[model samples]
Target: MSRKTALLLLPGLAFLLVGFLAPAVAMLLAPPGESAGTVVSRFTEMLTDPYELRIIGRTVLLALIVTVVCVALGLPIAYLLARSTSRWGGVLLAIAIFPLLLSNVVRTFGWLVVLGANGAIGRALTASGLTDDPPQLLYTPLAIVLGLTQLFLPLAVISCYSAVAQIDPGLDDAARGLGAGRARTFWTVVFPLALPGVVVAATLVFAGSVTAYTTPYLLGGSSQRMLATQLFSYASVSVDWSAAAATALIMTILVFLVSGLSSLAARKAATS
Candidate 1:
């Protein structure tokens, strides 16, 4: 590279190191005034302890469920939107991602209202004679999953839309000409081409769901704690810096692992 190009990149690289990398490394290593051994021991405990294992398991399972649900729903919507020739296509695309403009807290609270004992769902159930009383739905895994799915669905849709839109519509016609059905064309052509985008969407949604604090805390409550809430308890409530650092490290590792796997899958799909 030219000296000018190297110099131009220097400032951005310096900023990235100082701004993000250094602090992230420090946090994963050990919290302030804590020994590396302390953090390591706590991390080991979290892995071995049944309580902590359950929280971690719950976090992972919920995240997987959310990712699958979002991808299953988002991919089809994105495909339809991308293939639409209607003038309303632009408007429909905008509407698909509109939830992103709303704050996460706001959307989560909307779920709170709907899932609450006296909320819409409960009221409807009672009015329909499906139940004699309002069922407790707020502080369950289901609530957390629903809230997270709503929170991340728009992101998945938009990511897949961008991916699908980049592919040539002519490819679909070409597949049809070769006597391939719509399902076969999509599986053999469109889906493979769009796999990278789907991977990106899934990675983002999984990471967000696993680390998300607001939705899980509010929806799952004290009864159904996830890793993020556990970390919060360690950091703020219990004042256990070592454990908090360990939790953060675990979350970071989980995200990185999923990202790596997703990248590998996308590359394989692209090549195949």
Candidate 2:
């Protein structure tokens, strides 16, 4: 490459080296007095622990649930946003994306208030004779799912909306011209074309959900102990820096694996 091109890339390269790569290297190398082999052995032992395995399982399950729920809920809203020409489309898009602008702590706390025993939702349910007891909405798996879904819904909506908007309306029109119904055209043309976006959305949601700490920590109980929160507990509560580092490495690997698999599926779908 030319010197000018190399110069232009140098700033970004330096920033990544200092900001991202530096911290990752430090984390990997700075774990307590153990050698690399001992660190690997400790990690292996962690994997064999049933409690750790359960935490990993719950983390993966929660991430999958959040991804599925976000996609199912976001797809139609994205389609509407993509297809609408009304001035309100912009307004709706802004509303859909507004949550992403808020800090995750703020968003999770909002749900906490609403789902708490004396909160509006709980009161309304109790007043409406839905149940005799106020539901334990806070600090549950259900709460984690609800909070994470709300937190990640905007991502799915924006991804799907962008993909759907790129698709030519004429394609749908032509399918209709051939006597295909709305559902038929959408299933055959629109849905297939939008699969890339769906994959992107799912991948983003899964990654976010997997690494999410604040929401799960605030809204989840012992039963909902995800890997991120577990890492925090190790670092902060147990003061087990080595274990925390190992867990952090595992979480990073899992995120990359999930992203890589999603990318492969998207490419295959695009080609097929």
Candidate 3:
């Protein structure tokens, strides 16, 4: 309502319009010219395409798994960083975030080496009698999930740590002093306070996992296709920009619905 506030917001509004909205509009319109058939027909084709439908389903499944894995692993690391008093906590936090500083391709290649049939993990599993032979790790759903979890875990940790850090230390102290055990205090007090951050982290992880191109492409074989791979196939291989746009739009909607429902569910859980 204020002129000064409007002035301050103008740059951001301008950037959004120029950076996101314009390009998105262009892409959406690009698809309309692809076929002589109507847009409705293209939608039908996209929906009925069995391979693409499978890719969409698999992409959602993979993203959900990646989100769960990231949160499950990130919570303890975040708790440690949030509650620790030692210099090592900061050191460890930096180490946890260190992977994010590397090129995505580099990080993915690192996983490839570790998960390869001849890699250390595979050899160790075989040597330890965990398996009769080196398990087929790469080019599987397991490999993609692991790669995605590793790629996005830092975002989850940082989000959770920021949330956990915001809670009053005194609240935790009081809970413990009131005869609650450490685990009890965490569940009753700290974790509830950190729920919002957990939701944010989940959203980030899910969105990142679903939209990722390289990790899925490299770690997953032809059978383990995701939506990003499908999008790339359409755009590059088929040279169908319109179909690619449709895929992108579908992916955006999928990410939004999943994240929105997840955040809503988290809020409801927190309230009840």
Which is superior by TM-score, 1 or 3? 1
| Residue 260 local lDDT, model 2 | 97
Give the Cα-based TM-score of candidate 3 against the true structure. Answer: 0.91
lDDT of each: 0.95, 0.90, 0.87
Task: Using lDDT as the measure, name the better of candidate 2 and candidate 3.
Answer: 2
Question: Best TM-score goes to which candidate?
Answer: 1
| Number of clashes recorded per candidate | 0, 0, 1
Q: For model 1, which pairs clash? A: none
- Model 1 residue runs over 4 Å out of place are none
Checking candidate 2 for backbone clashes, the offending pairs are none
Candidate 2, residues 33-68: lDDT per residue as tens digits? Answer: 645665577688888999888888889998999999
Please give the lDDT score at residue 71 for candidate 2: 96
Global local distance difference test of model 1: 0.95
Question: Better model by lDDT, 1 or 2?
Answer: 1
How close is each model in CA RMSD to the real structure?
A: 1.2, 1.6, 2.3
lDDT of 2: 0.90
In the range 2-110, model 1's lDDT, one tens digit per residue, is 9999999999999999999999888878788898899999899889999989998999999999999999999999999999999999999999999999999999999
* Per-model TM-score on C-alpha atoms: 0.96, 0.94, 0.91
